[model samples]
Target: MPAIADRTDVYLERFNDALARFADEPTWLLERRKRAMERFLQLGVPSLKHEEYKYTDLSALADGQLLFATQLAGAEAALPSYAAGSSSDRATGAGPQVLGRIPRGARVQSLAEALRSQPDLVQRHLATIADCEDHALSAVNTAFFSDAVVITAERGAVLDEPIQLVFGDGPTGRLPRVLIVAGRNSAVQVVETYAGSGTYWRDAVTEIYAGQNARVDHYRAQVESLDAYHTGRLQASQERDSYVGSFSISFGAAVARNDIGTRLNGSGCECSLDGLYAVRGDQSVDHHTSIDHAMPHCNSHQLYKGVLDDRAKGVFNGKIFVRPDAQKTDAVQSNKNLLLSDESEVNTKPQLEIDANDVRCTHGATIGQLDSEAAFYLQSRGIGAGRARNLLTYAFAADALERIKFAPLREHFEALLLNRFASQES
Candidate 1:
């Protein structure tokens, strides 16, 4: 890896070289890209000393030489078969592809198209919710992203079918961007699937804007190559009486880091964040989430669980903040981890910072191996030892899986969990 000081210059050079590709873009977007590039340079690449990234290292990403993907190659193969009939909008490393029918009351288009057709709407929401000043990776994404998938749910529009987005990695690396805007009283669900091969890196950022009384459900599944590196950020802003549910599952990549943040910007808003990560061998996964109760009468709940085995490592740090003016705020956060091997390790921290006097908030974390008694009981029922352990692990993960209201996505994850554990049986 290059020295910490050189990393900034490397990325800066790349950013400068990438400006040629955006020459045809509008002046405002060009300016935004420049500003994001500056911020990325200012923050530089994070090291172990950085408090927010202390648990996850980015050296591998910084050391690699990856060029920005500029072509659409092999994206068709990356699209999932299950999403065939779903809203036909898919995004590959090159950009968004419109092949299938879109549900009513929703507009799904590529970011480039949206910028041209709905400049006002795209400008109003893009880069407004996610903070780039403090997040170097997000800044990098904002600066280098070639194209994005934009999904807009019109006012009072109820989308019956979920929007499926597939993002494939590029030859070297890719920066994937997604923006979701749910208008007043609108309801929609979005499912994002990331798949790629080789040792490429995927840096992704997703922003969700939920208008008054709107409901947005988001599901993200990352199943990249085992030798790849992935870092993603999900940020949501909720207006009055809006509801936002976010679920994330990670099962691939050598090193993966996920950051999720939600801001309750209006009263009576409710936010729920749930995540599950299962890793084996030398893989590592880290998740950091923050929920800000900026308004009174807002509620937030978070539950994140991890399963680690065979020297794998996992980290979960969740924080909930209730501002001084957020009276009657209610928030709960929990992080749990199950280690399937003696060599596996996990670090969990759940924190609550409440300034409001009349608010209710609670946070807790747990890290432990599978219950020996539970495994023993299952084995005594004529089940093999390996099968008993696998069953216990599945049961521990079922809670979060069951919370997924989308039946198809939930079933997909369940199958992944079963196959993941069963394949490793002794």
Candidate 2:
């Protein structure tokens, strides 16, 4: 058996050496990384018995299955969605690319490239969203971040196309981070796509800050291998009167988990989180989201949907916290699941923590099977079982896709959906 403590200590030591190789980061950023590494050492992986991770068993990862971060398995491997005969579309459907929008000015370069060309931008927002002291996952990512992408929208600019940040599967593990900052009055959309050739472990961290009066649209897509393991965390801080819209789709990993947190720190800020998770075979997927209202007059809404088949398992945990000063705040959260097989299962939890009596906050979660009546009706017509299931899956997921307004991206997602369904059917 692998010595968990010894292995983790040694990994941290090697990670330190790796940081020396990329020592060109700013002083403040480097110090922040140091702090995070300290925390990771302090709070090793939280136990499954922990209130937040109760349903999932992550001990296997700590048992040395996840400690050794390897390199990309096939250097020349293509994206799964882009693979010649593979089609796997989730809630957002399918598109030519994983993310629907990406413009030239939106910048999708590596961390080193950004450090050299756009130092100030990186300096302003890189490690701010996920402070070293706040989240352990962010700290872990900071200690191991191999490479990353940085996106920013200039003041007053509205980009129609969303940006895609992709990382492929490999022999080794991955630590990918993305930093997005929307200048005041600007509008932009960003898509993050994770797909690789073989089964691998992936840890993705994203930080987003929307300036006062800005509008930023975002989506995170995970379509890794059936044997792959994935963990992600998205942290956002919105300014006064700003708006942030986020969507996430999880369809592929053997074991996948996501942690998302949004903060409305300024009055009049608004946030919307829309997400979908689909599982099949022996896969398991989990999502945890939090919305914090810290100021007055802010608004937020969260909707998460899940589809499971075979022996797949799904989990959703959502929470909304309204602070004492956050009067007149409006928040709502809901989670819904569609179980397709007798062996499939799902666990969902939605909670609210309020300190302000004037705030309106509500949350709920539901687990159920697909509408059999609808499926039977489709079969009663000319549609076969597989096609009927596909049609109904599309219908169940269509609402989330409709949230996106980009015409070209929408069409691409539809075509992509057909391909994913085809692979599953085959």
Candidate 3:
């Protein structure tokens, strides 16, 4: 095992190459990029010794030589059309390839365009919500991300249609970024989908800001190739009387990690976090979430469920915090997992930290196999053993899926879940 300092030379070279392409950007942005790169160099890739990453290993990401997707030509061809036949506005790398009818009072554009046209707006909210200084992956993204998708809904605006951001695979490591801002009393839905083939890495960061009385529904679906590596982080901030719901559905990747963190900055705010992940074979998935109640009269709810088969591995860690000033805070969190095979493994931890004396917080975690009695009952009702097992597996995951309020998005995920189980039976 080499020292961590010895492993940063390759990333330093990549950062230098990235700076050359971003030379034409504004002085402020260029300076910020340089600072971020320096931060990454200071904090090399986390090793298994790191407490936060005890179960997952990222040695391949640190040691392997991967070309940045920005440097590769004709990489768009590798991206699959996951949103085919959908009536949603679409945006791809560096630009919006397919333009749909963007609702009135909403602005959607590429990060390059936003930086050039609305520099002040982009600068004010870009890295404000996400903590790039402390997290190494976020630092890498801030320093090396080629382009991003920026979505903004103005005050009192309501967008009934969803905004879809698609990231396709090419033969290169990719860093994708998304920023969404919802103004006071506004409402909007944003969906992010990742699909690709071949062996590569996708490191992504999404930041969302909801103003007073605003409503933002964010969804992410990761269906990359089984040979790929994926690491994603979602950071959200809510103001007084605001609402934000985040749903994550992951079914692909050789190894995947999903981190979600939200802060309730004002009173009378509500936050909901829900996720469902189904994995088979030797795939591994980890979900880590944190919800902070900084002000009084705030409420948060979290539920995460996983279905593992074969030799797949799953990890879930959820934490909720209530500050001393956060009186009248109400929080509830639960994690439940179902194992389809004896070889499958799960590690679950749910935590609650409350500094306030007048707060209600509860958390629990459960990991177990399917109910033998239930399976036998289904089998006795003329259903085959395999069919009965599949039905029970779907029922175990239905709770998290039902939390998705959008009809079309919910239906799409339902189909994906069914297809996944059907293929396993075949």
Q: Which model scores highest in lDDT?
A: 1
Candidate 3 residue-wise lDDT, 302-329, digit = tens: 9998989899999898988899999999
Point out where model 1 deviates above 4 Å.
1-3, 67-93, 96-101, 170-173, 423-426
Poorest stretch of ten by lDDT in candidate 1 = 63-72
Per-candidate clash tally: 0, 18, 1
Q: Candidate 2, which segments miss by more than 4 Å at Cα?
A: 1-4, 63-69, 75-109, 116-120, 132-134, 169-173, 406-426
Clashes of 2: 18
lDDT of 1 by residue, 283-358 (tens): 9999999999999999888888899999999988888888989999989888889988999999888777888899
Q: Candidates 2 and 3: which is better by lDDT? A: 3
